[model samples]
Target chain A: MTQLREPLSLISECGLPAALEVMGERWSFLILRAAFNGFVHFEDFSSELGIARNILSNRLARLVDHGVLARERCEHDKRKVEYRMTDKGRELLPAILALRDWGLRHSDSAAPNLVLVDARDGKPIAPITIRAHDDRVLEWGDLAWAEPGDVATAPAEACAEEA
Target chain B: MTQLREPLSLISECGLPAALEVMGERWSFLILRAAFNGFVHFEDFSSELGIARNILSNRLARLVDHGVLARERCEHDKRKVEYRMTDKGRELLPAILALRDWGLRHSDSAAPNLVLVDARDGKPIAPITIRAHDDRVLEWGDLAWAEPGDVATAPAEACAEEA
Candidate 1:
């Protein structure tokens, strides 16, 4: 977790930009997403994400380096390697799901439907929805200008005070 | 919307970094989230988000200039300006929700919980979650494999890949 910084440059959260700056790249989330998808081996991640071997190697190293994922050699295949999420990486699932849901809503969909739920259990662990102050679900433009609830604690300078 | 590129780099859909690049930034999502949370004035945004005047001014100008938000002189206060989400801006609700959802998950009551619901009646929109094919909620490491999934089509390679 990142430490909250004192308000600087008009933005209350200093960690916001750093979070965005580090996370704002393109492939990091998907790679993390795939991790949740259960492709633990180097070859499997490559096959599932369809990332280049070179790129996979780089991202894997970065994730491990960042302590988001842990790496170990595959026992079955001595030459093979396996990766798993650290608490830090596990924490990213919410963000990943949020992005998937957003993509499904704003853009065209591919059948895989980023989420896979238990048909039998009818339960999902990662369907992270945003709700209202009273605990009701919330949406865009729902705020009435009187109360800006559930606003993202990110950089406000780039965005307007619409919240 | 960005075109689906070959999985040349990590920023492809499978990666959270990619989503961050597209949606996560200093002010971009904050502007949207604030709108969703009910903020509407330049000063209010400056005050609440604590954004620097220059940066806030720039973000407001860009969003308005890009038609994401419309700047209408306050109906009553000519000196006052009200920023409203354009339909296009409204369309960004999902993305904003997505990131907010992400934040709620990684937080520990240090942050408030979030959800999406109806504005008129305050009904739940459903909590957000993410998972993998087995209907199992995925942890980031579950998919960390050496084999990059189908990233052959990515337009560019991830920087870390080169490093």
Candidate 2:
């Protein structure tokens, strides 16, 4: 963890750079948001997001190419195509929610007119969080990078020594 | 909630568009990641991220202008400067970590060489999750949008009726 404090050239080793490479742009994320909100048809995405045809087309194609979305023939209308979210795309929910929550809390826009609520109870959902395996909340200082092979050989003692 | 299923202009009403306006680009996020990894000096960011000096300067200035980072003179060396994370920047940890976790899991790259561990127990942290206020793990289907003013007038019956 702290080892990264030095210029070790390990930045590329993390998955972040790769993830950003795929969905780092604004419209891409907005398109993903639309997908999560149940947008599938090209026209739906274009009209609802109010995104330009070329931009929406590019982002959707990129998402499908990357496997985040799958292109499928609409069962109800074989002549029509739909962009469906793959499992990989669905799994990005937490990340999207985290950013949405951050934006809701910190943006200069007028207070959000809507809130994400739990369907069962109707209460607004709690903010997205990083929790330990045992369900304890964690802070930035509570994190460290495990040494190589340490996770397999001695997970418990890995960050202990550093701490 | 499900009302978004129709063509509504509410997409811009969510905080997501605002958030994307601020930090939706790849380099901005990468720079933030480097800062979280304890990089303070411009040279450290440029050398470690292999970012161009002009690009680094531009990103740093934008982050500062947005109040995500504060530029300060290094106390120990007046001529030297440090870019420190503001509270706003620190709050993005969950979003960043969530994206990092997604990348680690879905990217076509090789398995991650390092794991993020909890400093207290040295165990890998759990995946970021969306939890209900009552601590229940929630799926995407469990979420709905609260009607405007419903959060204040009838929080419990809002999504319940929709459900």
Candidate 3:
């Protein structure tokens, strides 16, 4: 693995902090999950999440402000509003799924009441994985950081040799 | 797509809530990131993160209690302690990477100062993806939930037909 000579410097510039600012809290994530489940109306989020009206309102507004969810008027009824996931919001699916999967494996609580399946085969979805550019499955030891210029010179066989 | 006839019912039992209970805070995640970067000593986390001593102590204990990290006495210097990621903590890599990637794209901040690379070839890592059991890449529309028994009866060609 490539050593981080100054880990602090790298950590400061990392995007995780910003992502956490928008999504670190519990309610926000629960709301996003509800949105993924196709709940659009304010009432749907409020009732389903058991979130207080004020807190739900705050989270929805924050999501909208951050471009994670879009706020728009209902097409048929101008007075009715809907909260929908934007492209950016949709991109978070992997992160959400990873967390959900981790929880399922690690949580000592009740067994999962539902499973995420492939609609085509109705089979459970495969666990999320980290893959190399060549589609090789990668474990933690397989990852490293390097200077941009170093990438081009490194050989594809390097991994094989390391293994 | 399989409709969530009762979305709330599923959300109520999701593992996400439990996962969030352990990892839903900003500092905990930052600490975990530091761990991934190879920082193990208490001072390493403290000085690198500039976190308050008391807060850091609390978060570390919580992580230890949840089994996300293991606290051990330093082998070389038994008087000193080190906090290391356990297998469960290592499993969170995908989730952390996903968030970091999302932030890099969405955060209105400075360009990333570092990049995650494949040690073998030194190339940048690929984006995290949701893949089918057969290794087909899946998008949000491609996903659905169904009863466990329905999985075996569903045709492999079902996805092709829907597409």
Candidate 4:
């Protein structure tokens, strides 16, 4: 008699889903986009996104509660509050920029879209990519999933490269 | 006094919002995650997400309509259908992977979670980054928006580096 151990399958992590749960809504990302572009007051986001005041208030409050944005009393005006990105919120920039870059490259826009440039050089920033620690550019083919704590045998290919 | 020319303010692009409009819903991204991991049949998504059938049906249809997923008859079964990621869908990997990577690095998970590894060498992929044309690593301070047709003059620094 012979026995064969089934290969251990890695569990799919839900971190991305959890993120989407918090900021994946249409208005939320746009609000974040506006904030990144220096829009802090409620009126700015409202005018920029054309969103109603009530909706903007709800979205901003939710972001603040999630620790993505901080609501502090405006230093210049005691009666006004300003929203700024917290450290947690700043960590989200890569993902946001990834989406923005994808949209810029893949979208079918009839009108010219805003271009992201280096603040120092005026050149457009490069696309976001997954590179090896050795700096090799990786495609989906170059990836596989591993269960945490698994013995680090050479990982097998997850799938073949798409044509 | 002469009228002043308003500095050319760049218009924020809408592609990211359009993307969110398609796959920004809570469950939609989860479904895409499953698809990227090789889930295709309706039953697989149903079991994995534990979502109601009607809701799943709606989400799948929406994804198909948005060109993110393609619907085709299952080869193994004449009556069953399978969903596959289209080229447009595949292009979204950087963004999705960015979100996943962030969640893995920043989430409050106390236990081991799934990890993405190099299919070739079994090493973990590097974190996604915003880079310059010369391959210099970039930060928030290194970026700013430019109008599409703005002069190609050198840009000034957006902000100072963070610690």
Could you estimate the TM-score for every candidate?
0.52, 0.84, 0.85, 0.82
1 against 2, candidate with superior TM-score: 2
TM-score of 2: 0.84
DockQ (Cα-based) for each candidate: 0.13, 0.42, 0.41, 0.34
Worst 10-residue lDDT window for candidate 3 chain A reads A1-10
Q: Point out the worst 10-residue segment of candidate 4 chain B by lDDT.
A: B1-10
**Which candidate, 1 or 3, has the higher TM-score?**
3
For model 4, the local distance difference test gives 0.72
What Cα-based lDDT does every candidate model obtain? 0.53, 0.77, 0.78, 0.72
Identify the leading candidate in terms of TM-score: 3
For residues A1-163, could you state the per-residue lDDT of candidate 4 as single tens digits?
Answer: 0111112232565577557656765478878877888888887777777777988888898889888999999988988889999877887888888887666556576644567777877776666777665556677778888775772653343111100
Summarize candidate 1's per-residue lDDT along B32-143 as a digit string, tens digits.
5566456899888877666689988887887776567889998788999999888756655544544444444444435332333355544434333343322233443343
Docking class for candidate 4: acceptable
Considering only chain A, what is the TM-score of each predicted structure? 0.67, 0.79, 0.81, 0.79
Candidate 4 C-alpha error for residue B134, in Å: 2.4
Q: Write the residue-wise lDDT of candidate 2 on B10-44 in tens digits.
A: 54376776567668754788899889888899988
lDDT of 2 at A110: 71
Q: What TM-score does candidate 1 get on C-alpha atoms?
A: 0.52
